[model samples]
Target: MTTARDREILRLAVPAFLALVAEPMFLLADAAIVGHLGTLPLAGLGIAAAVLQTVIGLCVFLAYGTTAGVARHLGAGDLRGAIAQGVDGLWLAVLIGAAVTVVGVPLAGPVVRLFGASADVADPATTYLRIALLGTTPLLLMLAATGVLRGLQDTRTPLVVAVGGNALNVVLNLLLVYPAGLGIAGSALGSVLAQVASAAAFVVVVVRAARRHGAALRPDLPGIRAASRAGAPLVVRTITLRAAILVTTYAVTVGAVADDQEVDLATHQLAMTLWTFLAFALDAIAIAAQALTGRLLGAGDVTGTRETTDRMVRWGAWSGVVTGVLLAAASPWLGRLFTGDDAVRDLLVPVLIVAALGQPVAGVVFVLDGVLIGAGDGRYLARAGLVTLVAYAPVALALAALSAGLVAIWVAFCTVFMGARLVVLVHRARGDAWLVTGVVRAPK
Candidate 1:
């Protein structure tokens, strides 16, 4: 029984890990393409990307909220509810993605300008943002699909989409950036095209899922109503979480503006890239936490959910150790691969050390988020995130201002997330409250 349970947990977490890793691979490829364009171009890409992350992250409730609702529906065996979320979330995604693209394309320059992008990098940032924003509609749709699949315990579709999109992006990057001479714009364009392909691929999977597992509503009206109602809090929860993240990102932008800032644009970019990579990599455990916990919640097996959480968090810790060591070990080589600039390299390599070590903290936090969400506790997820941001973001900004170097910034980063994990862990462990009747139905 023990061996079987462990194997089952691994089954959920492995594809989840792959899916999570693939999500961040998109940006890493972009960073690589931009890095070769020389420092100014790279820096510009970094600043603009930060702004873009904030924007997209703010609206991420689309994915998280949808995932939670879908998971709950599946647990209740409401196939119609799951399908309803898939369809309605898709509708919501298209509109939201379109709005972002429209707003971003026109305001790309102004947004970067607001971030205090150096005069040299301003135009490049705008160019890059414009090209990338074109694919928002499709990208948003893909997010919706992934959320639905995750909720339904199907990681295969997301994995397929991720691989296909990444392959397309690589080919497009080679052709568009090199042969076509689109510069950074080509990088952005490549990503957009790749995401479109992913979206199309996922749509097919979603259709199949409906046919195989969903409740085949006549018009799917009832499923739609229930999903929409359940999804509202989730949406609000996600949007709020995103809003806080955006605020922190904005602080990073502000900190980047210091004249004596030890961390330049490339350095900042490297840190963010490293951060994104680690967070996504560790997110595999979170994905695991989500799937296993969701399944347990669906079946009303509270004990299974708790046990799964413990194992995944430990897995998260181990994964964090391995990832962090590798990143730190590769710091020198990574710096050389991306840039030849000695000054830029020195600053970034140290930051990489900080970035890597933070993975465990981040891993725990991310996994907790998934566990809680799967348990239908998005409201708590939202609150925890907001509180952490409030406490930690200011400290980061202050440290950055005091010394525009990587050490202070990273220390702050680690501290903030560690604090977050601790708080959540304590509460969950101390409370049997999660098992109370209707707690999942109407979570606090």
Candidate 2:
């Protein structure tokens, strides 16, 4: 990542950064609105979000997979390959999202119940979860579009689309969740609308780019199928990770109840929210790595990919440290946003403190995850992520039993994710032949 390459990467990453950041903005809005509704609704919303994310979160890899495959194709001077993946990615995303939308709507309540949310909490959670599930298709499309843009080294367009959508979300949330009086359902509606807008924007930009590049978005079927094949490993990895994280939420929630404390749940949710913020923010580096490194690999510039990945990892670490410090400093005010009860705030402070401390490690894990995905090392993602997430389940319960509350839970979380990433990243970096070769390997 020389200065010139850094600039080029930034040109793509910043937009991805902006768009991804917009995600939490919407979540924060939901939390704020639901917070105003009181403890039950807020808790329910948190549980709903967790459940929905578990089932649908795997779709997230569409962005990374598309970027890696498309960028490599472009780098290899195969505009056709890039277009094919883009088209196929869009179709694949739609297919998965549609299936989820259908299956999830019926199972929403059971999913919430499995998380041990109270009967009172389950209904609202189900309501919110179902609506959010509807947004999955558009969300995937928007994400996949970002991949296409990143491949072309055109990050700004996706960022603009994301911001535009975020702006729409904020407006909708303010209107629907409040004066309009839709309650939790309003939150879901706002999210879906925002995603739809962003997806539309991405499609427009992608179509325009295809025209400019003299490629067709309507890729040939054979090319689409081939690129689609290239994307499967990453999707499996993403879905596995999502499912693992989803189960952890249930474990944490049940443990909180068994520990005989309401604050346990609240505090953990607050800490996770903070974690989400840090993870999403620092993921910009990961996105940059995936885009640029994949481009280099595609172009047969293995040396460049190696150099850029190293630089991005360093950058991610530094940024994570800064973010941790800032988050720790802001914990007092941030805790108040979740709940103002002194006891709850007390529980929250320690959780945030430890969580903030782990930001650097978390950042490393995330950045590395993106790099590997970009490099097409996603086949092992399911096993790797499951190891990390599952490691925390018993620890969460044990900590809760020890009256350790949220701090212990987060500590366990840190350990699991850190340990899991440690092995996978090392394996890849150390020349694991099976996983090290990216999607865009040079012709023999």
Candidate 3:
């Protein structure tokens, strides 16, 4: 028999999974459209996308933090407070997004240059990045708004908006890239416009909820400060995580260039893109874990929290196994969809297999990460992220230093890096430290 908890988990996870997959579809669509342009353009898109994702990834605290805060308030029977907290988070997003755009636009060229990519690759990368930075504000706005809705236990809205936005992005890219003849810049412009539309839709929905619940829509200075305070540890945590990825990317670039193997760089790009897609897909359960853990803790239901955590862990592991099997089966033909280069496609196969083998570990890490986040255990998470990064960095750098192949690089990341994360998270989850039950998390 399906218990009420199981039903709720399904209700949230199903839509959340769709929404998460849709989020990565934006990148996949971009890769597909841009790949046909030329090797240089595709390579350029890889560099630009890495920089863009890093920025967005760093700001993810807006979503995770807001989700926990809003869900806790909602569970505590304070709908108005939940909406108000979300409003403050939205305001923070606007400020942070604007600031990022102002700084990022001017540095696009220099940042891409930092990768030491050839001029042919750097030129298009700078072009795409400069245009894409214009959409940062709206992108962050969407993140904060999605957090609000998720906290309200309405993942379906995000799924609808994300799917619609992805469809629009693809259509616009097709029209602009070829028919309109804007080249790679056209792809960037299309993505920006789609993001703007999604952000607007989210804003409307969040504002309606706020008005209906009589929550003030104006920016609350103290509230914003509080949100910032709560999100500080998460920002550190995300920074460390992003740092690890950036280091891995840097390793790939350096190793490829050192070995005079340009195909390796492109192959790593494709592998990373696919890995991100899988990560988000598996994160659907994590999304459910985040919302449920926060709400359950807020209601002071300790047993329910423990039971739900265990169930979600199982769901995450099984989902990873199933996804891994499917990905491994499709690995042979997957690279052809992104690029026509035979070299890149061939190199991608083995790298992806290594990634496939790590899915179960990835699933558990993502879920436990979400569970702790939902419980507002940001401080420990922050420390753990740093520790994981510290342990993994040397091994990755050593591989790069030896000029090991791309497959070796990915093996280190998937096994050494991911394995380290799994260990720390498992240790934390096995303890009672994160089981604090109340509206506000108790200090450790």
Residue-wise lDDT of candidate 2 within 305-406, one digit each (tens)? Answer: 777777777888888899899988988778677665566677777778887888888777777787777777766666676665566556666665665555
Residue-wise C-alpha lDDT for candidate 3, range 1-444, written one tens digit per residue: 238877888999999999999998888998999998977888888889899999999899999999998899888988999999999999999999999999999999999989877888889999999999999999999999999999999999999999999999999999999999999999999999999999999999999999998999998888888888899899999988888888888888877754444577678778889999999999999999989999999888898899999889998999999888988999999998989999888888889899999999989899999999999999999999999999999999899888886899999999889999999999999999998877783222
> Who is ahead in TM-score, 1 or 3?
3
lDDT of candidate 1 over 1-444, digit per residue (tens): 557667876776778778777887778887787778787778778777877676666556556656766776777778776766667677767777888887788887787787665677778888888788888888778877888888777777788778778978888987898899988888998888898889988878777767776544244445445445555555555554445444444455566655623236677777777777777778776766665676677778877777777777777778888888898899877876666667778888887887777776676767777777666665565565556667776676676566455556666666674666557655764476544221144221
Q: Count steric clashes of candidate 1.
A: 2
Looking at model 1, the pairs that clash are 61-238, 75-298
Runs with alpha carbons beyond 4 Å of true place in candidate 3: 257-261, 441-444
| Candidate 2: worst-modelled 10 consecutive residues by lDDT | 435-444
By the lDDT metric, which is better: model 1 or model 2?
A: 2
Query: Against the hidden reference, what TM-scores do the models get?
Result: 0.90, 0.92, 0.98
Give the C-alpha miss distance for residue 298 in model 1, angstroms. Answer: 2.1
lDDT of 2 at 424: 72
Given candidate 2, what's the lDDT at residue 380? 66
What's the lDDT for all of these models?
0.71, 0.73, 0.91
- RMSD values for the candidates in order, in angstroms, are 3.0, 2.8, 1.6
